[model samples]
Target chain A: MNFSRVIYNKFLSSWMRISITVIILIPFAIGIALLLKSLPIIRSDSIFNLVGSGKWAPSEGKFGFRPYILSSVYVTLFSFLFAAPVSFLSAIYLTQFARGRLIKLVYPVIDILAGIPSVIYGVWGVLVIVPFISGFVAPVFNTSSSGFTILAGGIVLAVMCIPYMLNMLLEVLKTVPTGLKEATLSLGATNWETTKHVVLRNCFSGVVSSFGLGITKAFGETLAVMMVVGNTVHISFNPLQSGYPLPALIANNYGEMLSIPLYDSALMFAALLLMTIILVINLFFRFLMYRAVNQ
Target chain B: MRKRKNIEEKFFKSLSGLTTYSLIGILLFIIAVVFYKGFNALSFEMIFKPPEGGYYYGGEGGVLNAIAGSVYIAFGATLIAVFIGIPAALFINIYLNRMKKVQNLFRYLLDALWGIPSIVYGAFGFTLMLFMGLNASLLAGIITVSILITPIVVRTFDDVLCNIPKGLIEASFALGSTKTETAFKILIKQGFSGFITALLLSFGRGIGDAASVLFTAGYTDLIPRNLDEPAATLPLAIFFQLSSPIPVVRERAYAAATVLTIIILSISLVARYISGRNTFSNIK
Candidate 1:
């Protein structure tokens, strides 16, 4: 009986270890799986033409991704412009000025905002931001839009990203060793001066990592951005113009992929591209963060 | 110099305050817009009954199919994630506790997995299904969503497990407990609240996410009766309905979005309440 019990314990231990191995292998499995699915497009088309050309006529066997890639970049850039200041200032207020009750209240609000589904954001975008842009903002800027522009997508994404960026920024600020702040205060430096010199200096890497993560996030966002970004397969830098992002391209084409030869491969390649870009960005930022911590 | 410094301090303070309050204002406005548009079209039948004929064309019916499907898929996925996640997290924190390098590497990998977008998961899930000769069904969705949320569950649980005092484990060992025994009996008991919170958080995320299930979970107007049947989800319901050219269908989409939001908000509230209550206070 004792021997059986010992064997049973050993089995359980090994089972757990195996589970850990399986868990650890997931990311690699996903990467390989995506690569294999996208292999067809990669083989048929020149790599440079696939990504560098603006034409995306899959029916004719051309799958240029330049327009989609540029659209993703521009939308993410616009989101950064709109969200960075709001989140940064909010982080400063929460960490430096807000008291216990205020912080307590604000934390849950941010969590709620983060917890809201992306689709709902898309719906809200269609309902409010879309009309607001085409009717009010576009007229002011001397342009008429369908309200489904890169600018509308950016505004919606910026709202969705604010809570995430704010949460990270608040965490970075909170880790700024209280002793340093006290020292600066004793030296009679004003609050703004101390924040600019001490808090910002110490958490520069954290801030950078947060923004980098946010950019990767905006780049990969699909359904919400898809619903509002107009899904136009054009290469234009105008924020008010309709654009097609990579993830949006993957999503919008899935239904019709079966009707055309190589269409499935094309969408798979888009998914692969998005996955690779996000993974690379995540890895680079993690490395930067790891080095900063060690230094 | 003193007066100039005071002015600068006041200006920055007010600026920060302005930005912070504006964020709150935006959140409120979003909620207001969703609820307002939703309530106008929301009805008792919309909540209790499935769609009737011609439903997509402003037909009569509640999104009962989608509501039920979302719950079913999210529940199944959360169950799988919990089963996989709890053991892996416990193994990392308990069995491999002494290896700091190994632990950090595991944490870093989990974080990266957490950051990978759900759409990639959807595409990968689709590939896996094809490789396995499976079709888009409830099972595919559950599997895909489980993959998407397992990292979240493990990371959340790991955050709680990391805070377990070393002395507790040492005491358990001194009491002649094996590593497995200590893990299951002591650590699990102590971290029960965190585990529950993790479950709810991942469930909330699983139910709310549309991108990951867009391809894996094929849509249907009827509630799936088995693992092999296609299932509709609330997020996808909203996405499809909102895209329709009909005004009434768009209103139904708003109603669906409202329901999704309320469910997620309640889950967050419950998580906070559970975490705040701090069970096992007597354990210390």
Candidate 2:
């Protein structure tokens, strides 16, 4: 009857099941640990004031993080301003206007774009986007500055976000079904009329959701952004200047984080802050996704 | 008014067309620039030898150390992810198959995990390492990356297992097969191809991710001698090399990026081929 083998299988099955449950909770565990680690700083420095203050020198016992928070918000919002319109139009082109073979080519290209590593994107940005902007985009403003500016960050992030926005919007556009488009066309509407009045209208919620996801993508980017965001801690709204976001700051200073008092805790707080913002956005995206799936 | 409507439509059509083509142009431009710059520094010594001087210096070494480190950490992480992820997947798809609501929640949690950025994982990994008083090493990196990829593997495997015809599982149960046995014997075989795809995809993701291991896998010019020893990865190598003010070192950075890109591309292509048309993405 091999009773021992049966017991072993049962043990293995149950143990693995429990292990996976633990595995799934890892992010939460880390999140809670970060909150705890950041507690000293949170207790000493009020989070609101801490986040709103611009002085960030831990060596000086000052922990103002408004600059970083504002940088993140501005860059993400600016990136959305650049990405949404371009990706929206691209999605429209892909689903409604493009030929069949072109659609096939573009879809796989986008999928590959998504799979390409962020470091590669960083490298490409350092060489390509940075150069292009510094040489061309900057000259028009009569500025002679290094290439690693916030505008560079925004442009690179906008490029990185195209796949996220395009893919979701593509799905939304496709889900409009052929019959709806055909009916609109049968009414003697032009392709643009059929699309503007029908396709985009059908996916208005999806278009909004894509913008949300795109914002999240831009906000969470670290390596590519750090490479070209000039890595300065100073906060500013000007895209032409160098500024640091939270993830970029963490990636930049994590190595030396333990060297200063409460520096590690501050980094932890920044991590927690980044995760909270992203998670909130993601939760909203998930709700939208669920709605999209239902529709 | 009718003519204005036509003009407006034409205006939008051209605008969208221009933007779409330009987006494609940007992708093509990135690839072209990477290839052109990277090919200049590509050499056997660049790939085969570890750095002799320093990573940032115009050292006489290749990226062998980083390459081996990436494969090692990714392999270890994938092993852990598979060990934990497959069971989670099986639990969701097999044991709890009837619990539609619970499965949806599980899937939702995984989706959220996917949404968490890699740098945040790096931050979390760094915190854990500091708490444990552990140095950045292959083991710490492996554990961190395992957590990073586990959700991906489970989500992929769950989707794959879901696509397995229910009749087959029912048939196994109808034959008086035990729950675990039926799972191992039927679900595994039915879902084998997709399983491999999930494993390789996550492995590629683990290897390609720099932000997650940026802090956990401390850079080394030498290959890791043991699990506790720090290891370099290709992405970090590229980052350091590119950051160097020296032109030769910057050239090598391009070369390293090319290698990393090729490795990732191959892994993805292989995954696509193995999963075949069930694409898993339907498997879409």
Candidate 3:
């Protein structure tokens, strides 16, 4: 019986280890697959020419990712700036100031918001935000715009990110000890003061980590942003001007992979670039979270 | 100074409250818009029948093709994800319980995987399909979505398993239960509800996702009869129809969106309900 038990434990442990090995290999497999497929473009074009130039003329063999990269950064950053404050405040309200029943009600709403697909958000963006931007926001600035600008994309993205970021922030805020808040209150601190000085201070790392996560999410978003952001291949600094993002570039052109000589490689390269950026962001934030937890 | 502090507090409190209210308002508005437009365009024929001639040109037929495709792909992907993910999560939480470093490493990797955008997955899936000499088909879509959502399933289930009380495991082992017996008989039994919730959550994600399957699942007007055949999905259906110049097509897009939204929300509610009930039943 003892011998059989030993063998059983050994067999189970080995099987579980194999599962871990397979799970661990997945990211690397994806990375290598992307890298090998994109290798042709990487080999044919200088890295600088690929990333630095803004020309994306597929017919001419030029595959400059500058415009797409810049637009992605601009849209993501804008959305993060707009979303972070709103979600932070809302999370505070829900976790600290709201009653139990109100909080309960809000959770489902948040879940619904998060559950809504990117396509629906894109639809709403086209119907409402696009018109609002072109007709009202753009005209106010005396600029004739198509309304498919980084700003519109940013707005839709910000709305999408709110529930996501707010969910994380709520979790972080809840981790702040109740006793810590009570102590501040007992010391005659106003509720807001306690929140600001104690709750926020205590969970600062968590807040930052959540924002990092939100940024990663916003950066990777393709469909919704693709729909609203005018898919113009231009290096535009203006939020009102339309710009193409990296993921949009990949999503738009992968259908025509066979039309051009290096088109597939170019799109694959774009995927590689996006995957690399997201990987770095995730690692950096994961490190932050790990350190915060350990501390 | 005291007056200034009080005013600042009041100002921030009102701002937060306003933001929270607006957030809820936005959710309501989105639902209202989808339903208002969708219910008008939605009909029994739309839901029950496949698209007929000139569907994209505002002809007779519904998105039954896309709806059916989405269900098949999501179901297959979720099945594969659960098959791989549960074991991985169980391994991490149970077998490697004592090895914190290894556990954290696995977690970090999974987080990285979870953070990857679906579009990249689409591109990668496309590449994989090409290499394997496979055209865009239901099988390709299923594989891609499974890869995309496996991390989500694993991570969510890992969180569930991690929260399982340690005493239960200890008692199982103390009763001379072997690791295999303990894992299947004890941990699985303990986290069954959580496993269901995780499945539902990932299934919802798979069904709703448009980006990953964009290239891998070649859209079809008819429901695919086999794994090798192309499949249309609701999100892509909504996307294509919305982009059409015809107003009628755009309205149908909203109908599709409404259907997709309803399905996803129902899944979320079920998962939430299960998880809520789980907490009550869990031993403290």
Candidate 4:
């Protein structure tokens, strides 16, 4: 009877605390596991030098990651550049300006976009954006491009990233006091001036949080980019050129890693690098959030 | 000065309107393009039947195998994630209520983990599977995906739990209810809709992701028979078809995408309905 009573009371707090701690530690555990798996490659080739060289010819047995790293950075950079203005502006419109009918129609659509499978964006990217850019947009810049390129991937990512950034920005923007805008207007500030001076100023940290989330989302994106990026190891600066990014590289090579010596560890190391980057970025945002919460 | 402000307002308004409209335009374009390309290819048999020869190459079959595989893994992963997530969420808000630093630390960790790329989860899961000497099977996929989404579930559920009124908890306790009774019976009951929404959100993510399962869940022409069997998913089905050289097979990729999109759209709609209906359920 006493044992049963102890078992029953365990539900009040003790068991929940233990299990939750274990569950929350899972990602750290996974990260450690990846680090361990990649230990061989990291030990053989220092991470800095491994990513420093520009060649990754597996047949000849070199696994330099300069190209894929460059590709991931540039593609994500371009995606952020393309997505930021549109996402922030639209979020402002959605929160401060949009009215009943427009809100009813547009808001739900944005929510749907958040949940729309990555595969659809990929399919649409492969079908439309790739051909459109390669055929028309590329020539405007005097470059020959294929449907499969980083530019196409960036376009898909911009669309996918917009909904997420918008969600974050909207949440923060809505919290801006209407009275502040009203007071600014009373002081002869125009609507644009009021929003620029008051709303945007107040939501700066949240804006940072949103962009941090966007970078994380775009950086780790695999499938949508994978379908369109011409999966090549060639390291090029031009977005018009097709190349492999880190996540896509890992996805495509994991199956065949066993056939080659040390290929699996290289891929695991890349994943480790990717996870570390995301962790650092998120830490920056969490600092911002902690400030916001304390304030 | 007034004229300058007027011009700025007009310009900025137009800018915001243009970008907002572009967002709507992009969504419509994606839906239109997918439907336009895949409409003719989408048929009952195409959805209901499994591919005959091979999934990657052109074949004379439906996407039944992939559809089944996606649902099985998603449902299984969601079940596991929910069971794990709810307790973790409760623990954060309830068990650690007095320990603000610890609660914030857990939240921060979950958020960081949530940002970890799904492909990284695949890598981690593959490593785990290697240690156990397992093949790419449905079980591996479910485990990896469960890892991928559990943080997300806990974070969102924590949001709901945090909003539960303190008064409700105190009242339950004042009525001589145990902490367990107050948490599960009252707190969870009130947050039920938000909890369901969290589940739906994670489930949709699990079903939609290809990267997390690409290595862990080995693709096949046949549906997964049991947890140990290999599983094919809709995303992989569409991926294999889209990459095909054959035009007919490329069109079929759109069909597969349509199926995936429809499933996600319906799930989101249901979530909205649930959350909308339960707005008044909070303790007054």
- Window of ten residues with lowest summed lDDT in model 3 chain A: A286-295
List where candidate 3 sits over 4 angstroms from the true fold: A2-15, B280-284
What's the lDDT for all of these models? 0.87, 0.84, 0.88, 0.85
Reference contact recovery of candidate 3: 0.69
- DockQ-based CAPRI category assigned to the predicted complex of candidate 1: medium
Put down candidate 4 lDDT per residue, B206-282, tens digits, no spaces.
99989989999999888888889999999988998888898888888889898898899899999889887866321
Give TM per candidate.
Answer: 0.97, 0.94, 0.96, 0.96
Report how far off residue A159 is in candidate 3 (Å): 0.9
lDDT of 2 by residue, B156-257 (tens): 888789888889989988987777777777888888987998899899988889899999999988999899999999989889889888999999999999
| Residue-by-residue lDDT tens digits, candidate 1, A8-97 | 678767877877888899999998988887788889988788999988787898888998999999999999999889999988888787
> Where is model 4 chain A poorest over a 10-residue stretch in terms of lDDT?
A1-10
Better by TM-score, candidate 3 or 2: 3
Task: Choose the strongest candidate by lDDT.
Answer: 3
What DockQ, between 0 and 1, does each candidate earn?
Answer: 0.58, 0.57, 0.61, 0.63
Q: What lDDT tens digits, residue by residue, belong to model 3 across residues A25-125?
A: 88898899999988899999888889999887899999889889999999998999899999999988887677777777788888889988899899889
Q: What share of the true interface contacts does each candidate keep?
A: 0.71, 0.58, 0.69, 0.82
- TM-score winner between 1 and 4, please give it: 1
Candidate 4 local distance difference test against the native: 0.85
Candidate 2, RMSD to the unseen true structure: 2.4
- Steric clashes per prediction: 1, 3, 0, 0
Off by over 4 Å in 2: A1-9, B1-14, B280-284
